[model samples]
Target: MSKMIKPWIKLIALIIALPILSYISLRVGVIPVGHTDVLALGSDASSQAMIALNDNRIPRTVVALLVGSVLGLAGLLFQLVTRNPLASPDILAVNAGASLAIVLVTLFGFSSIASFTSAALVGAFIAGVIVYLLSANGGNVMYMTLAGASLAALFSSFTQSIIAYEEGALDEVLFWLTGSVAGRSLALVTTLLPWMIVASLCVLLISKELETLSLGDQVARSLGQNVGVIKFVAVTLAVVLSAFGVALAGPIAFVGLLAPHLARYMFGTAFFARLAGSALLGSVLLLSADIFGRLVLFPREVTVGVVLAVIGGAFFIYLVSARQGVFKS
Candidate 1:
């Protein structure tokens, strides 16, 4: 009973903390706002605060929550598919594909949030297939890791070259490249939310099958599962979610890789529970990071990606050193 109740307790605690953090996110920004005055009645001083809260802070917070949730889900799915704890859209080239597509669009003078998102979908699919094919030899984890790392480097170079050629747009592209939720709006959320919802629904539908697959191919097949179909669908869902995240906030690394592991430790091996825990934990991590980024430099803001990269890079090294190439199996 104690063991069974612990997971629920952890999950509930996470769920409760999410909204509190979100509210705090709205309240805490470079421009301090009078929360009570803004909420109760509008005054001259409160007007500017309201504008910032409604236009900038709220939208940014929502995007962070949505993107974080999808990335968390995608990370868990990727881990199950690759049977690798370190697997993530950024690490596995899915975000690279999306970033490449968006960079190309921006370079061509035909860039919009919607276009970047659609292009990212195509790129993610293509990149995922390439990674799978390269690593398809008995699903060797090492080959997939090496191939993903190589492609990520190649795609990043392509992105950098394009940005360098378009010197005038370099700053704008650089911001997006660094991964941020700044300047995003509710409209961006409205545009991308459908894709996120569909992808999330797909994850829900495959939850049970994913649990089986995690047990191993032989067990899944013995239990009458179609391994190929399940793997394909699962991978597709992961790419979609990853693409949405990249489109929303350039390639925020480690949210996916870190979220799932955190969830597993808290929620045990139950698929749906782990997914929920991951999403909630991811939201907290990202929102907190964004909040931290806002204050870390005072009037100057740091991108959440850079912040996570510093943290995640350290964590990644620790993972490799500790695991020695073999993660939790």
Candidate 2:
């Protein structure tokens, strides 16, 4: 009963918070936006505030929302497939792989966001596959995490090496390498929108199979679920979603890890409800981080990625304390 009530309470809070955050995001950028700017948005393209609103703030806000939800959903899928609360796209090298791919392509003069989106998808897919292969030996969560971490480090080092060698390319990939949503336009999202929609629909379609799989392979198989196919499809879609998300906002960390856990806390562990909760909460978390970054150093903006990294660290520490069995060999 308490759990049931809790989800409802959270749902209500999120409903209230989202619009307020969107409005605040519009008003609180480096450029001043006001009631007049909002009214004259389409009528006057020449106004500085209107230009900022049309070109920058709206797109940034949309990117944050879309990236947040996609990462959250992708993280949930990874966690569900691996049965590990700590599994996330970033933690598992998916983000690093995508970043490396984006950097390499940018170095070669393919600097467009659309090109980055395609490269990121391929890179994220390859990295996800390798990490799974390395850890799929029925390894424990710690072992899988280590495997992912090692790959992430290796990929990240290679990325740094390239950046150092080609100093000029550093500027191109800096926001991407560090993970940020700044300067993103809806055009960036437009390139990947079709695929994102398909991936999301596919996830929903197989949700029942996923829920059964959550009970374990034996249970899913007993219920006539094609465990192998389901896992493959689920993982593939997850990688794709994460890839697009990274492309859009560069690897904004921790939303993937934080959102699912937060969702379960709010939605009481039902897979569908948890999924919705994760997406909603992810938007809330990312937007909150972006808002905080805007204000924390007024007139100078901190990247949303940096803000999330700090928040993710504290949350990980809390998880370690609360779930201390992670230390067990």
How does each model score on lDDT? Answer: 0.84, 0.85
Q: Cα RMSDs of all predictions?
A: 2.3, 1.9
Candidate 1 stretches greater than 4 Å from native: 1-4, 37-46, 325-329
> Weakest 10 consecutive residues, lDDT, candidate 2?
1-10
Q: What shift in Å separates residue 187 of candidate 2 from its native position after superposition?
A: 1.8
RMSD of 1: 2.3
Q: Supply the global lDDT for candidate 2.
A: 0.85
lDDT of 2 by residue, 150-258 (tens): 9999999999999899987578677667777778767777877788778878888887888889999898998999999999898998899899898888877899999
The TM-score between candidate 2 and the true structure equals: 0.94
Model 2 ranges off by over 4 Å? 1-16, 112-114, 327-329
Measured with C-alpha atoms, the lDDT of residue 236 in candidate 2 is 91
